[model samples]
Target: MIHVVFNEPDVTVINQAIELDENLKGDVVLIRDDYAVGPIQNLYLGEGREARKQWWSAVLAGGDYDGKADSGEVDDYKTVAELVGTMRRNPDEIIWIWAAQNKHDVSGYYWLLHFMKEFQGRVFILYLNNLPFINEKGQLFYPTWLSTIPPKEFLKAKKLARPITLSEFEVDPDEWIRLANEGKQVRILEGGKKLSQYGEEYYDEELKKFITGDWQKASKVINQFLSKARQTTGDAYLLWRLKKIVSGEGYDVQGEMKAMKDFEVKQKVGQPA
Candidate 1:
């Protein structure tokens, strides 16, 4: 058995759960890309994948992100290819895809399901969509990310796993195709499997709300935005947007724009504080 998760933090938590429940023994594979952002046009094809890589480079442009552009990072295609190869060689191998209700997980699920169409019966989904779970506080709550759920609660989550239906194999790939063709930069989960796409600037206003006339570290502003916003994206992406806003007339910026910590931002003097 193989477990697939979208978020990196989910890996440690799932491993902890596995230690407690031997029945959940499996190798955990993480898909690295956040499909919710960037251009996903023709994502299944080689050229399309290269284009998205270039888009990520562009997004990381003018930022000091530890030289991600030059690292030649392995993508989801390679990871999925390896999984598909493993399943092909061993018919007994089953795949369990775990996702939570947030856009990041939901979008990753949509992107991955397209590749696993051939193994319909063997592939299963454990989507915690609006489902209540026990938190570390011993209180009931709905988790938006698998990492947020306590390790032991995953024992209960195991029962939610179910095979990807034949109908979904046929219909869901079409939805992914539609989303890819739309080529929008941001995708949001409306509910369930439904996703809505918007432009890159979708979160700009929200980021701006946290910025005030008083100058603050770009990182601080971004942290506040992440903590307070109804929905959030990665800090690197937010920094990119903040830089774009700085390039415009809306905000004043000081210091190098290479990284969040390297700069400071505030609203213009006459702008609302």
Candidate 2:
């Protein structure tokens, strides 16, 4: 069975994967890092319900929710615990796909990935930036912090795949909703996953190694990389685009995608469809 836990939930890719096999209706699934359930930051989107509540609690406690951007740190919600509980309950399922925006707070994410890989599940990852790797005497090793992997080792997917820029993981939207209609679970998580990658000679291990111990550095590298990629990618605009295709109820896709924001959300979800 193919199970996908996409970070960004690309409509085209999600749709196409489901089309790859009818069983995808039952095969694919999703889960989040226990940290994901907390209030989001750095990125400029509204928080999820859990995050909103926590933010207000801080305000009530006089801890400050509307602090200046560059001011002192705000305590984040502990969604990682929530994610951990979910994984412990369903450890057998192999994850065909997954993603993350940061690495330091990803123990739950990495633990699950290793478990799935050990079980020989098809594993694919869509990290915000390139998956980390180290080279030793022509050996390529990607480190997973959940468990300390040795420096000169290698871990390739036995039945797993991940999205890289030149070779992105693809899924089709129309097909995904079809599976959703069939009583299968294809959830639209509250936020989106914007993906990018780098490898080969560009794997700059020296200046970037601090990423293994520091999220600020890793996040900085990824942001710098993606800011440049956007010069070419023009942004997939996943949420806006996906809603456009879905609003048509499978109609007017061509014209809808290029329309202005006002038009995209103009059609209601169940308007006589």
Count of residue pairs whose backbone atoms collide, per candidate: 0, 20
Q: Tens digit of lDDT per residue, candidate 1, span 1-273?
A: 899999899999999999999999999999988989999888878898888888888888878574585575746777888999999999999999999998898888888888898898999999999999988888999999899999999999999999999999888888988988887899999999899999999999898898898899989999999999998999889989988887888688889888889999888888875
Return the lDDT, model 1, position 188: 91
Model 1: lowest-lDDT 10 consecutive positions:
66-75
How large is the C-alpha RMSD of every model relative to the true structure?
1.1, 20.5
lDDT of 1 at 77: 76
Candidate 2 residues 1-118, lDDT tens each?
A: 3444433233334445456545444343444323222232321124343444454343223112233212423222223234334445676543444343333223224324323322
lDDT of 1 at 153: 97
